[model samples]
Target: MAANKAFRFFDLPPELRGAVFSQLLVSDESIILHDTTFFTLPSAGNWNFLNVFLVNMQMYQEASAIFYSMNRFTLNAHSHRLPVHLTSRGGFLSEEGKDARRRVRNLTLYLTRVGGEFERVIGPALSDMVLNGNLRELVMRLGPPSSLGASRPPERDMEQRPPFQALLRLLADPYLEKVKLLAWKAHLAIFCPFHLRINSSRTDTESVDNQGIAILRNSTGWVELDWRAMVDVYAPGQKIVRIGDRTY
Candidate 1:
């Protein structure tokens, strides 16, 4: 009976095995690799099967080159290898062992400043991936400003800070069609309203600050601003600068 069984999985043929492996890797609900329940392995749980995979020469050869897509890489103070591997690989995907690094669309960057030093070297390859690829959405949440100490700075610096420019540059993407800012603080807010007409159709155009409102007005696109800071909207033939909404 044991000999009759004859390693059922191995006997199924290489193509079948490869197909199954691909399905397992791509499955979102069934084959989970991250945070899980009691039955499933935890993120930090040791992967003992890795050694077994490495032992079989043919398996090792296949596994060595295989890059699974639709994967999640989590990181923290406790473990370091998971992030390192994903970043080193540049988050590239292998569709049956074909490289597709330039096709990545979604990214969640959680960067932290450790011991007053920014760790860019943690993932140089990933940066290459972004630079070389077509990125549709870039969600970056930098830990915090390293320089903001316990003591607050002068009021003049706050007003003069170029936070708006930095944010605009950060959010700009020529291929980007949709943009969303989760929670951000800055000097100016630029809104490109959905399906807004550029040509004149008088609807509260007067009384806005000319300089502040001119940039967005001339652009021919419109978006509703949800600003945390105070803003001044300016347009041509406006007597005085004024901010209508307290919170937008």
Candidate 2:
């Protein structure tokens, strides 16, 4: 009599079995129903795919772990109109935390004028994730403002640059180490005033960090920020606004 498929899967040397499964798992395409069923069926993949990789176990754990680490979400201001789309597709706020942990290691928030209150929704979302010690890398896109709805005043727009101030405050927690801000407009730019406090423990410092607006009068368009350099810009002890580099 032939060995059962499930028996065959477990029968292979444990190392060999894990390698084969990992090869089959890593792919550019999304996993399908049959693919899921193959690993899920009684005679096929382990029933603990969700937990073994997400929560408990260690040996075959990395095999399960890869699935969670690879989950990445890209948010655009255009789609910002339908925020539920992000919440559903990204699974950022899963009750189990494991689901969220599995997929939300890297977050890319795309900016378009269409996504209402991009800061309101994305800011708090990222902050919550940071507080939970789950977020890894945060990437911000500075694209044209969302035009799908009413427009904001020019002054409000200046204030809305990158939530660098809020982000620095949150990053004081220390677990989070990397933050990148990508700018899309020549005139619109964000810079943390030098002398940003590392730990906002003092209450009566009486000196609120200056919120200086950077005005760039060029048209190079959107450019991704340098992570290392950004840290210096936000580091405590630097001045509010100072001339550094110009491409014009």
lDDT of 1 by residue, 1-248 (tens): 67666566667677787775554333233222221111122332454434534458876555423322333322221122234333333322212111343433454444332211122332332334445644455444422223222223223333233443333333443344334443112112223232233344744332223222222333322233322121222111222212232246
- Name the 10 consecutive residues with the lowest summed lDDT in model 1: 32-41
**Cα deviation of 17, candidate 1, in Å:** 2.3
Query: lDDT tens string, model 2, 142-184?
Result: 5443431233323444432455444444334344545666654
Q: Where is the poorest 10-residue window by lDDT in model 2?
A: 32-41
Per-model TM-score versus the true fold: 0.36, 0.49
* Runs off by more than 4 Å, candidate 2: 1-7, 10-22, 25-64, 77-82, 87-103, 113-120, 144-153, 156-164, 167-173, 185-221, 226-248
lDDT agreement of model 1 with the native:
0.34
Candidate 1 Cα misplacement greater than 4 A, ranges: 1-15, 22-49, 56-67, 75-107, 112-124, 131-139, 144-248
Position 28, candidate 2: lDDT:
44
lDDT of each: 0.34, 0.44
